[model samples]
Target: MTRKQRVLFLCRDNATLSILAEALLRELDGLHFDAFSAGLEPADRVHAAALGELRHGFSSLDLLNPKSWLEFTSEWAPEMDFVVTLCDESARVDVRAFHGTPKLRHWTLTPSAHGATHAIENAFWQILKRVEDFIAAERRPWPSSLKLPAVASCTTDACDLLLSGQ
Candidate 1:
């Protein structure tokens, strides 16, 4: 059997977007991917709206904790196949290459203000859509040598190309 690929999602704070992405991706395609999320500066807790939405939609909330990006830098951490930045702040942070030279993708998303139910809901749906597209791309059959250009847009075709190593 082929080994599962590891994916790490990042944002400025792990409270919302990154947390949603990690859980959504795991719920959507856990068999093929080990999904993780971390933030540059982690919050004390996961955002209530994000957690509540996830609790409503998913069976498990075991992976919903906010965590620091440093956790993934340890020698013992899983080597990621892909490292995705989900917000502009995280995408702008300059850092050395990740372990295993994981392919990087940026998904620019707006963070909702605290307690804005509608905004959080909007972000959740956006993240869910992106996660689905990412799964589809990873599962598609493509030539190994044909790398697509890495576009900043989160369109389905762009996601497929981004993960194919641009």
Candidate 2:
């Protein structure tokens, strides 16, 4: 059997965007992907608003927790197939390379300027859209030459559509 592709999502704080992406991908395609999330500097707990948004879509959230990216630096950590940064801050943080040399992609999503709960709710939908698009792209056949570019290095709007594997 083909091995599941492992993906890690990173952000400044593992409170909202990264958490949502991890849960959405895991619930949507656990058979094909192993999803994980960590922050450069993790919060003490998952944000309450994040948990509330997740409750609407996920029944089993026992595993969700805010953790440091340092946790994945250990030899015991699974080799990631992809490392995705959800925010600009995370994409800029200098860090040691992942063991597996995973493809790096940045999905530039910012929480809405609205109040906390509304912001988390908005981020949930945005992340869910990207998560679903990512899954669909992963399932399609692609030529080896068309592998995803290092989107984290791309600082322009031109790279936005690349997330859809277009």
Highest TM-score, which number? 2
- Runs off by more than 4 Å, candidate 2: 94-96, 110-115, 140-166
lDDT per residue for candidate 1 within 94-159, as digits (tens), equals 545467778888986655533476688888888898999999898633337766565566988777
lDDT of each: 0.82, 0.83
**Which lDDT value does model 2 have at 29?**
88
**Candidate 2 on 1-166: residue-level lDDT in tens?**
3678989999988988898899999999888898999999999998898888878768558888999998887888888888899888889754456786787889977647223777888888889899999998885333356554464566456666566556
RMSD over all Cα atoms, model 1: 13.6
- Backbone clash pairs for candidate 2 read none
What lDDT is obtained when candidate 1 is compared to the true structure? 0.82
**Residue 59's lDDT in candidate 1:** 61
TM of each candidate vs. truth: 0.77, 0.78
Instruction: Tell me the lDDT of model 2 at 157.
Output: 60
